[model samples]
Target: MATAEKDGKIYCRFSRPKSLASMKVEEEDDPSGPTEITIDLSSGKVIFIAVGKTYNGGNDLAEHVEAPVLSSGKVDFSQFKVARGTTMTLLTQLHGVAMVLAWMLFVSFATVEGRYFREGFGSKMVCGLKLWFQMHRVVTMIAGILTAAGFILIFVKVKGLSKNAQAHTYIGIIVMAATCGQIFLGLIRPDATAGWRPKFNWAHRLLGKATHILAAADLILAFRLPMVSPEMRHFGTTVVAVWISVQVVWEVTFEVNKYLQSKSPKVDSIPGKEETKIEEKVIWKDPNGRLQLILCILFVLTIVSCSVATLCAILIF
Candidate 1:
C-alpha cells in the first residue's frame, strides 16, 4: 500500500488491485454515496461499484444504477485505489459542493436578486456574504451530514490519539449542539424573523461562531502536525490563532470594501421608485427594516468575535 499525505494532515493510502468481488459482497455499503467505492486492502484498486438497494442487485461496479453526485470529471483509471486518512479532504469536497448546492436552493427558494441578473455569475455564487444567510438552511443540513459522519469516524477509528481527546470531544459536542440549534432557528425563522429576529439572529450567530471554533480546534489536534517536539495542546492554540487571524482579516476587509462601495456616489443614483423616509412628529417610519439590518450586523460581529475568543479561551485554559 502506498500512502501519501495529500493536504497537510489528510493522508491518502493508495493501492492497485484488480476487482475484489468478495470484499464488496461482504462489506456493508457506505451511505455517503449512491455507490460504494471500495478498496482492496491487498492491492488498492477502487472499484467504482455499488451494492443494490433492498429489492435490487448486489455490489457490481458495472451494474450500479445511481450516478455519482460528485463526479470525478472524466474517469481516470490510472489514479485509483486512494484512501484518505482524515476527514478534511472529503469534508472539503462535500462542504464545497454542498455550499454550491445550498446557493442554488436559495436562489430557487427566495432570490429577488436572482431574477434581476441575466448574465454573469448568477446571484447564487456571486452574491455577497448575505448569500450565506439565504442559503444557511440548506448548507447547514449538508454540513450537518459531513460533520456527523466525521464525528462518528474520528471517535470510533482514531486509535492512538489520547492526549487531546477531551478537547476534541468538547469541540465536537459544541459543534453538534450549535448545528442543532442553528437548524431549529432556521425552521422557526419564518415566524421568528417576523418577531424574534433579534434573538434568533443571536442564537444563529453564536452557533456559527461555535462551529468555527470547533473546526479550528480540531485542525490543530490532528495527529501529525508540528511534530517538532511540541506538546499536542500547542497545536490546538496555534490553530485557534491562525484561524481567528485569517477570519478577522477576511471579514474586516469585506466590510471595509462594502462600506466604501456603498458610500460611493454612483450607488445612490439607481432609478428606484421613492426615497425611504418620513417627516413624522418624532418617530422614524422604517424602524423595522433598520432594526433588521442592525441585528444582522450585530450577529455578524458576534460570530467573528466569539470565534476569536473560543481559541483564546482554550489557550488560556
Candidate 2:
C-alpha cells in the first residue's frame, strides 16, 4: 500500500495480484464527511463507491487516558478521577498537590514567620533554637521536600522536558534549582557573629523570595497551558489571585505596624529620679505582636484554603 495527496486531499492506494488495484480517498479538510473509494479491475472496468465517515482517532490524538492498574492485591485507582489531557495524570495530580502545598502554603507561612513573627516569638527557644527560627526551618524543610518531590514526579511523567509547555517547564527548572540552592545555603548558614553572616542572610532571603515568586509564576503558567482544562485553569487562576492578594496585604500591614512600633516612645527612669519619656529605636520588639499573631493565623488559613482548592481543581477534574 502507498499514499498520495491530490488537491490537498490524501489518497491511499492498495495493489493486489491479477492486475487489480484500489484507491481510498480520505476527507482531509473535514473528516466528518463521507469517504470515496475506487477499484480498477483486470477487465478495464472501475468501481466507484462512497461510505459514511470513518473513525479518525480524534480522541486518542487529543488526549491520553491512563490505564487502570492493579497493585498490592487490589486496584485502588478507581477511587480517584483522572482529568483528560496528555499532562493530566495521577502523577501530575500528585505533582500539583505537592507544589501547591510547598510554595503557596508551607513556604508562604515560613517566609512570614521568619520575616515578621520573630518579635512575636521573642527569644523563646525550641530544641535549643529560637522559636521563630525553628518553625521557619521546619516549615521550609517540608516545603523543600515537597518541591523536590513534585519536580521528580512531573519529570518522570513527562520523561523529558516538554516542548509545548515551555514556560512552565523552564520556570519549574529554575524554581527547582533555586530551591535546591536555598536548602544548601540554609543548611550551612554561618553564626550571627561571623563577619559573612550578613551576606549569607541576604543571599538566603533573596534566593528564597525569588524561588517562591518563580514557583508561583510557574503555577500560573501551568494553568494557562493547553493541557489544562478550562474549568481547572479558571479555578486555579482565581485561587492564585486570592493567595497573592492576601500575601500582599499581610506584608504591607506588618511593615506599617513595624514602622509605627519603631517610632513609639518608651518610659525610662533613673534609680533616684523621676520617670522620663525617651525616644528609642525598638527594632526587635513589636508592641503589637498580638496583632501579628492574629494576622499570621488568618494568612495561614487563607494559604491552606487556597492550596486545597487548587489541589481539588487539579485532582477532581
Global Cα RMSD, each model: 17.5, 12.9
| Model 2 score (lDDT) | 0.74
Instruction: Please give, for residues 217-271, the per-residue lDDT of candidate 1 as tens digits.
Output: 5444432232212333454455455545654564565445334433222223337
Which candidate's lDDT is highest?
A: 2
Per-model TM-score on C-alpha atoms: 0.38, 0.68
Note the Cα lDDT for every prediction shown.
0.43, 0.74
lDDT of 2 at 4: 96
Backbone clash tally (model 2): 0
The deviation in Å at residue 42 for candidate 2 is 38
Which digits, one per residue and each the tens of the lDDT, describe model 2 over residues 1-317? 99999999777766476443333334334455434344434343312222233235431121222222212122232244322233255687788889999999998888888887787877899988998898889899999899999999999998977555577899999999998899789879999899999999999989988888888888888788754556778888888887888887877877777776665667777788888897666655545566777877888788888888888777665
The ten-residue window of minimal lDDT in model 1 covers 112-121
